[model samples]
Target: MVMITASGKGTSSTKGTNSTKVASSTSGTNSTKKASGTWSPPEFDESLPREVTVMEGEPAELPCVVFKLKGRAVSWIRQRDLHVISANGLTFTSDERFKVTLDNATSSFTLGVAEALRNDSGVYECQVNTRPKLSRPVSLKVLVPAARIAGATELFIRRGSTLVITCTAQLHPTAPSKVEWVHNSSVVSISGGRGGVSVHTERGGPQLSSTLSLAKVEMRDAGNYTCRPHSLTPASVTVFIVDDEVPAAMHHDSGVGRGGGCPLPALFYSALAALTCPALCPALCPALTCPVPPYPAPS
Candidate 1:
């Protein structure tokens, strides 16, 4: 036979044919447990940069700083395409250009894009999956540099003719605020004299556009002229003017001068021909290298 007994204060039990006492008892008080330490979710840095500008072909960085992380995760996403770029300090994008670096000391999860392109200009988001899901939007702006002259690379005009050329630059509306005209690599200004050069800005286009004009072309203007603008790659235009001596040579006057042949102007034309021979000048070439001017003598 087996016997058992119970009460509010305690309990006991026994089992046996001879009443063997396999006893058990219970106490009135319940077991106690210690409370755990307080924990908080991660938070983002408030003073993060809202907009970042990086030049094209360079690397861009978007920072994601968190406080009191408590084992939370950080992630970066491309807002334009909604593609997950990085998660938990690991890169999720298959692109080799995308990477994530985590700094344990500063709790910074910065996303890096290498060799940035013009198409990469857009908004990106840095997110922390915390209790409230903290996030900060960072706008990435990519800048591309470009400049070009919109006309024939070289222009030929007769004396007393009006010469006009235009220069246009991309990625800037009024870039190169100052335009300068250079001849033979020497700075030439718009002198207040007859047949002078002048540069004027035209406001008809979105990008920056400037027009350089010579009111009346002359023999002295028959050299390589450079169109240089501030913060832009300079372009050159070679202006060739026809002289009366050039035509006389076509009429069996190819010999020496005054003996029924061309004059000094003919030598100038010949020099130009030799300098611009098909074997010398490439099809798509820039201005010729100017001979350095002689050093000025001390006064």
Candidate 2:
């Protein structure tokens, strides 16, 4: 007599011949085959941008795109402090400036920061829930807008000469909205017959220039000139309109008093006269003898 025993279902023991019958069932199937029929694993889209840039005080957005996301959750973490900023379209940070948004059409999770500051620039991670926890790093750069005049803080332009001053505004990743010129606390105009004054602007990349031109600079044009970039700190330069004809008897070289032995600092004779002399130093600049060197034409 011959006997055999089968342990589990889908297995049959036969006593008649040297043969056994087995039935294939799902319970005995491979795990990979079972998973193949379920939802696909989440994968990050490599074609999307891996870095973001924005100007200070502007809104900044970083995107995280995934393929076959299914029910997986997406999160944004600030790498600077390893702080969780948002997860699954919900913000976890206390700061009201940070927010998360989800787009079902493109399977994207975006983190937005309003009024972005320089301190907000850093690496951020886009995380997706998975067995191993998949993540992608994205870099953020924030630039502060800086506006400045091209020349020195103080300038002297000879009367009847063309005065060309340029103000350059820089805001990396973006451009300044507007640039304006102010003369002696009054706004300068490019048109309306405003004393031959004109303004020209040009932009390239992150930097732009605004040129203020005066056809024939006169005494009236001498004063404080300010360049104001919209929503940015304004820069000012002291301007002096000097006469082309210098006094024959007076020689101003290193303050070596030649006209009447009037001893004055060399700074008084320099282009910085509007800053250090005439009004501020009346003792050194006598009205009759020293003659307060004809620097800025009398207002």
> Number of the top candidate by TM-score?
2
Expressed as tens digits, the lDDT of each residue in 175-286 for candidate 2 is 4458889999789997746578889988888787888899887778888888888777788887666575433333333343555454654335443445554544435544
The C-alpha RMSD in Å for every predicted model, in order, reads 15.6, 9.2
Q: lDDT for every model?
A: 0.65, 0.74
Candidate 2 ranges beyond 4 A from true positions: 1-42, 68-72, 104-106, 129-133, 151-159, 168-179, 189-194, 201-209, 218-223, 240-299
TM-score of each: 0.44, 0.59
Clashes of each: 0, 0
Which residue runs of candidate 1 sit more than 4 Å off their true CA positions?
1-39, 148-299
Q: With candidate 1 superimposed using the best TM-score fit, by how many Å does residue 163's alpha carbon deviate from the native?
A: 8.0
Best by lDDT: 2
| Residue 271 lDDT (model 2) | 33
Candidate 1's displacement at residue 23, Å, is: 33
Worst 10 residues of 1 by lDDT: 24-33
Question: How much lDDT does candidate 1 score?
Answer: 0.65
